[model samples]
Target: MSDRTQEMEEQVAYLHKTVEELSDVIAKQDMELRALTQRVDLLIRREADRQSEAPGAAIFGDERPPHY
Candidate 1:
């Protein structure tokens, strides 16, 4: 094979390897994002349940005046 043809083949192989590496990185990040989202959802539901269970509890920043 000619030198130019060999060079082209090597470049193609390098590009293919780079693409595969980037794809793997993206997949790992996607999985982490999904896990974080689920955790946040669970925390929100837990807070809502706590508030529902205490109907008359004084919420943050809603305290009565000291004189009262």
Candidate 2:
């Protein structure tokens, strides 16, 4: 084979390997983002339930007026 043809083949192989590595990295990041989104959703739901059950408890905490 000619030197030119061999050089082109090597370049193509290197590009293919690099593309595969980048694809795996993107897949891992996507999975992590999905898990984080689920956790945030659960926390939001829990807070909403607490607020409904306690009514004004959050606004009054454990403080007292000056005549306590």
Candidate 3:
């Protein structure tokens, strides 16, 4: 095979490897993002529940509004 043909093949192989590595990284990040989303949803629901349990509840234990 000619040297030019061999060089092109090597470049193609390198590009393929890079693409695979990037795909794996993207997959890992996607999983982490999903987990974080679920956690945020749970926290929001918990806070809503706490608020519903006590109307006008103070965030810092009886810390009323400045206007009050």
The prediction achieving the highest TM-score against the true structure is 3
lDDT of 2 at 33: 94
lDDT of 2 by residue, 1-68 (tens): 99999999999999999999999999999999999999999998887777769856653434586698
In candidate 2, stretches whose alpha carbon ends up further than 4 angstroms from where it belongs are 57-68
List the global CA lDDT of all models.
0.89, 0.85, 0.89
Query: Could you give the candidate ranking by lDDT, starting with the highest?
Result: 1, 3, 2
Encode model 3's per-residue lDDT on 3-61: one tens digit a residue. Answer: 99999999999999999999999999999999999999999889777877886765653
CA error at residue 36 for candidate 2, angstroms: 0.8
True-structure lDDT of candidate 3:
0.89
The clash count of every prediction, one per candidate, is 0, 0, 0
Q: Lowest summed-lDDT stretch of 10 residues in model 2? A: 55-64
TM-score of 1: 0.74
Q: Which stretches of candidate 3 lie over 4 Å from their true place?
A: 58-68
**Every model's TM-score:** 0.74, 0.72, 0.79
- lDDT tens string, model 1, 1-68? 99999999999999999999999999999999999999999998887778778889755435677888
